[model samples]
Target: MANSPQSKKRARQLVRRTTVNKARRSRIRTYLRKVEEAIASGDKNAASAALQAAQPELMRGVTKGVMHKNTAARKMSRLSARVKAIA
Candidate 1:
């Protein structure tokens, strides 16, 4: 019920932002899933590579406001540790 023109415009902008954010979130999840699958497969080299590839994507999510910086850092830390443990 956006009666005011400004409110209507804001609602439209919100829809657009939501679409973009959803895509960014989905892309970030895909990268994280790749790392997880690589780690689960017990391939050290592949997991390391996947982790390297995912690092920037996760950071991008933080910079884009799709995820919190500390959340991304925590995930990266835990994932890297798990990757390291996969001997």
Candidate 2:
């Protein structure tokens, strides 16, 4: 029940932000999933390329406030390590 005009405006803004954030989160997940699938397929080269592509998108999520920085860092680190270990 946003009675005040400001509150109503804030609610509207929140809805907009939520939609944008959801899209960004979905995009990030898609990139991560690509890496995961490549890893699962045991294609080291493909996994490395997917991870390379995903790293920036994940970091962008952090920068855009869709995800935590350390969370992104941890994901990138683990994915990179896994990519490296895939021989």
Candidate 3:
């Protein structure tokens, strides 16, 4: 229960932020899933393209505070390596 006006305002802000963050997270996951599907289909070129497209999205998630910097970096590194190995 938000008794104070400030607390009520904060709760409202939190709800808004949560919705935005959820959308961002879902968008990032969609990008990652595209990359994964491309990889699974054994198409190196498609996988590379998907990875390239996803890289910025993942980085955007980091910048937006949806994900950690190192977490994004590690994901990019592993995905790129997998894409490279597709050949």
What is the Å distance of residue 20 in model 3 from its true position? 0.4
Candidate 2 residue runs with Cα over 4 Å from true position: none
Candidate 3, residue 11: lDDT = 100
TM-scores, all models, native as reference: 0.98, 0.97, 0.98
Error of 2 at 9 (Å): 0.3
lDDT of 2 by residue, 24-63 (tens): 9999999999999999999998999999899889989999
In model 1, which regions exceed 4 Å deviation? none
The whole-model lDDT of each prediction reads 0.97, 0.95, 0.97
Q: Model 1: per-residue lDDT, tens digit, 1-87?
A: 999999999999999999999999999999999999999899999999999999999999999999999999999999999999997
**lDDT tens digits, residue span 19-62, model 3:** 99999999999999999999999999999999999999999999
For every candidate, C-alpha RMSD to the true structure in Å = 0.5, 0.6, 0.5
- lDDT score at residue 87, model 2, on the 0-100 scale: 84
Model 1 superposed RMSD (Cα): 0.5
